[model samples]
Target: MRILLTGSAGFVGSHLVERFLGEGHEVVGVDNYLSGQRRNTELFLRHPRFRFVEADVSAGLPVEGTFDAVLHFASPASPPHYQQHPVETLLVGAQGTQHALELARRDGATFMLASTSEVYGDPLVHPQPEDYWGHVNPAGLRSCYDEAKRYAEALTMAYHRHHGVDTRIIRIFNTYGPRMRADDGRVVTNFVNQALRGEPLTVYGEGLQTRSFQYVDDLVEGIIRLLGVSYHGPVNLGNPDEYTILDFAEIIRDLIDPRLGIVYEPMPADDPRQRRPDITLARELLGWEPRVPLREGLERTVASFREVGEGRPERVGVDA
Candidate 1:
């Protein structure tokens, strides 16, 4: 299949591009490099089956192609990155999503949206399932990303229902692995970088805010399965394992240097108190569940950071 993938230079997008190419698919990658790293695409620059286009999806796709699939992974996924460019985040979610849907409609192709777990927003329901109506602040500091994704999901469903576009929505949970920007400000990269540098790990608030971390490979596999099936879903794709920020910090510290100390800071506004996906639907529908343990995933992520060298830390944001 020939796939048109937005944000293909991002951490997850880059990995997805490699996965598709490895599976003998032709992939056209589009990115503006807003928060995505160009170096992530360096390896694939010469791949015969891969083509890269530098463009922002918010304005338009600006490419002509009839693709078998349209994967809309564009957006500032991390809190810091999105918050830094709130308008761009909103535009990408709204306009960019609309453009992708139209492209899929034009080509009569399958459409996959990379939605985030942030839509759950300090969720009142534990182990959030696909049916849970999230408790989100439409005008909070994090709303730039939260509401944008909510709107994107609504738009995706509208396109599916009104226009009969084949659509798939996978609410991605916290994912980490190779190609993540060192200063991306997500918890995994932040902790791993600090631990590697022998610096005190920064923990927000009481450091008890929890999150579910999934390996990128697991997420990519879940996405591929969803695309192959006829399920018009908003499936949760993430590990069911849960960990508090403080516990996660210690785990990374121990992994890098058992003696590293931690410093607690106030938690950011609207930070989710807990996050654990109920992946029963994914298992039942797609026969998918995360396979990488947190310890092992962190080790792999840390190894990548080591190879790349610790990038300068940017302002911390809400934990993914």
Candidate 2:
């Protein structure tokens, strides 16, 4: 199959590119490098099955060939990063998605939108089911990411509804693995970096905020299953195992360097107090469920971090 992948240089996109190529598919990857790293997909540049285009998905994306599938994974995902470019983030979710859907429609290709768990903002429900309408704040600092994803989901379903365009939506949970930006301000990266550097792990609020972590490999496998399934879905693709923020930090500490302690700080605005996915729908619908355990995932993540030194990144700040 010939594939077109947006955000193909991102942490997740790069992995997807490799996964597809490994399956003997020809892939054309497009990225703007705004949040994605060129080095992430650098190794695949020489592969005969891989082609890359440098362009921002929001402004415009022009591809020369028809594809068997189009995976739209563009958009800044982290809170600090997306908050820094709120307008671009929103545009990528809306306009970028529209462009992909149009391409899918024209070529009769499968379209997969990489939706996020952020759509369920500050979720009131304990374990978010796929049917649950989210509780999101429209005016919070995180709204750029949260609302944009909600709009993206709406756009995905709208495309499925109005045009009968074949579309798949995977609501991803917290995923971490190799190639993740060391200073991306996400919990797994932050805690792992701190532990490696012997710095204090930073804990937000009372550190009781619970979240589920999915290894990138597991997340990608679930994504492929959901996209390949015959039925359209706004399906939940995440690990259901839950842990508090502080507990997660401790687990990282124990895995990397047990002697390291933590530093407490106030939680960021619009940060969800809890998050866990109900995958009953995915299991019944797509036969997909996460198999990676949190500790095992952390061990692999720690090894990756060790391989890639935690160098100082350009100071990018958000109003969170």
Candidate 3:
């Protein structure tokens, strides 16, 4: 299948491009390099089955082709990146999603919107399921990303309902692996980098905030399976394992150096106290569940960061 994937140069997008290409699919990737690093796509530039286009999907998609699938993975995903460019994040989720949906509609292709666990902002419900409506602040520091994704999900459903376009919505949780930006401002990367650099690992609040981390490969697998299925769903694609921020920090600290210490800081406003996806629908429908263990995943990620010498302290300040 010929697939048009936006945000193809991002950490997850780059990995997804490789997966599709490896499966003998023709993939045309679009990215503006806003938060996505060009280095991530360096290896794929020579692949015959992969074509890269440097353009922002929010303004418009410049590529002209009939694709079998239009995967909308654009937008700044991390809190620091999205908060730094709030308007761009909103525009990409709203306008960029519309453009991708239009392309899929035109070509009769499967449409996939990469939504987020942030849509379940500070979730009151434990182990968020597909049915959870979420507890998001419409006007808050994180609202740009949270509400943008909420609106995008609504738009995707509208298209599916009105235009009869085939649509899939996957609410991605905390994902980490190689290719993640060293300064992406996510918990995994931040702790890994800090530990590697022998700096104090930063923990926000009392460090009781919880999150579920999924490997990128598992997420990509779930995505591929959902695309082939007939169900137009908002499935939760993430590992069920849960960990507190402090526990997670200790794990990373032990992995790198047990001597590394943690420093507490004020938690960011509207930060989710807990986040764990109830992937019952994914397991029942797609027969998908995460395979990588946290220890193994973290070891692999640390090796990748080491290869690129990415453990240095970030030059820019970011909220925790």
Candidate 4:
């Protein structure tokens, strides 16, 4: 299969790109750098099955041919990056989706948008289902990524409904793994990086907010499965093992470096109090569920970071 993957240099995308290449698929990677790191995709540069393009996804993307799959994973998904460049973030969410949808329409290929669980902004629901119409605050600090993804889903469905383009959306939950930007400021990376550096882990809002951290490998598998499945619209792809911010911090401290301690700080405005995906739909439709446990995943992530190390924190839009 010839797969066109945006955000290929990102933490998750690079892992996905590797998986696709390993499966013997022809892969074309596109990244604008933004929050994505070149080192993440560095290993794929020489692979005969892989090709790369350094272009902003929102800038009227160019394409060569029909692809078997179109995985739209571009856009600054974390807080720092999206907030730093809000307009560019929104444009990628809008234009990137349009460009991918258009390409899918023209090529008759399957289109899948890597939507975020952040769509369920500070969700009121316990275990958010696909049918839930999220409680996002359009004017909040988190709005850039949340609303952007919300609208991206809208555009994707619009293309599917009106233009007959094959489309699918996966609401990815908090995922973390190797090659994650140490300074990305996500809870996982922030905690891990701080631990690796033997510093206090920053705990926002009394460290009470919760999230189900899925490993990147599980997420990549779910993405591949969702792409091949016949589902339309969105599906929740994340681990259901919710953990409190403090508990997560403790785990990382214990695993990576015991010297790391926690420090309380104000939770950012509009931060979700809790997030746990109801993967029932994913199981039924894609026959998939996360296999890696949080402990194991964290171990793998810590080991990876130890080897490569986070040089300095690069501000990235915090993601789900």
- lDDT for every model? 0.87, 0.84, 0.89, 0.84
Deviating ranges (above 4 Å) for candidate 2: 264-272, 310-320
CA error at residue 240 for candidate 2, angstroms: 1.3
Candidate 3 wrongly placed segments (more than 4 Å): 204-208, 263-272, 313-320
Residue 119, candidate 4: alpha-carbon lDDT:
93
TM-score of 3: 0.93
Worst 10 residues of 1 by lDDT: 311-320
How far off is residue 163 in model 2, in Å? 1.6
Backbone N/Cα/C clashes per model: 3, 0, 0, 11
Comparing 2 with 3 on lDDT, the higher-scoring candidate is 3
| Candidate 2 clash figure, as a count | 0
- Against the correct fold, how does model 1 do in TM-score? 0.92
How well does candidate 2 score on lDDT at residue 147? 87
Runs of candidate 4 exceeding 4 Å displacement: 204-209, 263-273, 310-320
List pairs with backbone clashes in candidate 1: 205-265, 205-266, 205-267
User: Against the true structure, whose lDDT is highest?
Assistant: 3
Candidate 4 clashes: the total is 11
Mark the 10 consecutive residues where model 2 has the least summed lDDT. Answer: 311-320
- For model 1, the stretches where C-alpha displacement exceeds 4 angstroms are 204-209, 264-273, 311-320
Candidate 2 residue lDDT tens string, 49-104:
89999888887778898988999999898877897899999899999999988899
Compose the digit string of candidate 3's lDDT tens values, residues 78-101.
877998999999999999999999
